[model samples]
Target: MGKLTRRADFLAANGGFRAPTPGFVLLVRPRGDDDPAMRLGLTVSKKVGGAVVRNRMKRRFRELARLVLPEAGIAGADHVLIGRQGGIERPFEQLAADLRRAIAKVRK
Candidate 1:
């Protein structure tokens, strides 16, 4: 429902529950503000690739979030997708499935 633009938000999410997939690590942190809206953040470090690759990964992630997060994401929480080296090579369908699986795991 929103984007997390602050470094602090991302850092806060780092301390939350994590679900690791082949492509990415998903982090879910409840804000406790009772807003009922989910905020999303994406990170692709230089360790993964250069700017172009990172941008592409982010674009894919944005689309993935659009498709999946509305239904699967936790309410009033920050959800971050941390790109791994495997992410750029992974199939889009597989990545989507990975995200879904991550969400399911975090919900438990």
Candidate 2:
């Protein structure tokens, strides 16, 4: 998973974020010539917890993005994965499915 170094670029160039019903927050940025290798940005707000709790959510987002992004063909696109308020309690499979859907939407 490449890092989402150009955060501002991603936010500016791509489509606005999408919230697909119950499970995920999908931020979609359009493809560009200088785009990194299907990069991902994970943001866990303070509302979730302190550093430890937020870090854990970030870790989960990283793992899932690595596993799913490439397969979804996220080249030239930037995606930021934000954890919901009820994060730890969310089912893993549901999270995965939400990511997959987000990837699909952005790729289109």
Candidate 3:
């Protein structure tokens, strides 16, 4: 429902449960606060590519979050998608399936 913008937030989420897929890693961490909204964070490292590639990855991530998070995301938690080297080359449908599977794994 929202974006995770703080460095502390992203760092904290890094310490939580993670599900790794071929295209990316999904990290989920409960905020332990009153807010019930799910927050999203995205990171496409320089190792992935230059600015254009990273930005493209981010845009894809944002779209994925918008489409998938509402029903599948954990409320009151921060969900982070860390782009993998294969992410840029992967098909969007496959990436989406990967995300869904990852979230399901973390929820268990």
**Estimated TM-score per prediction?**
0.98, 0.79, 0.97
Candidate 2 vs candidate 3, TM-score winner: 3
Name the candidate that leads on lDDT.
Answer: 1
The lDDT of each candidate is 0.96, 0.70, 0.93
Per residue, candidate 1 scores C-alpha lDDT tens digits across 1-108 of: 899999999999999999999999999999999899999999999999999999999999999999999988899999999999999999999999999999999999
Q: How accurate is candidate 3 locally (lDDT)?
A: 0.93
Backbone clashes (count) for model 1: 0
Give the top-scoring candidate (TM-score): 1
What is the lDDT, from 0 to 100, of the residue 13 in candidate 3? 96
* lDDT string, candidate 2, 15-96, tens digits: 6656453544778765567746666777778988888888888888777877777787456766777777776668777788
Deviation (Å) of 13 in candidate 1 = 0.5
Give the Cα error of residue 61 in candidate 2, in Å: 0.4
Better of 1 and 2 by TM-score: 1
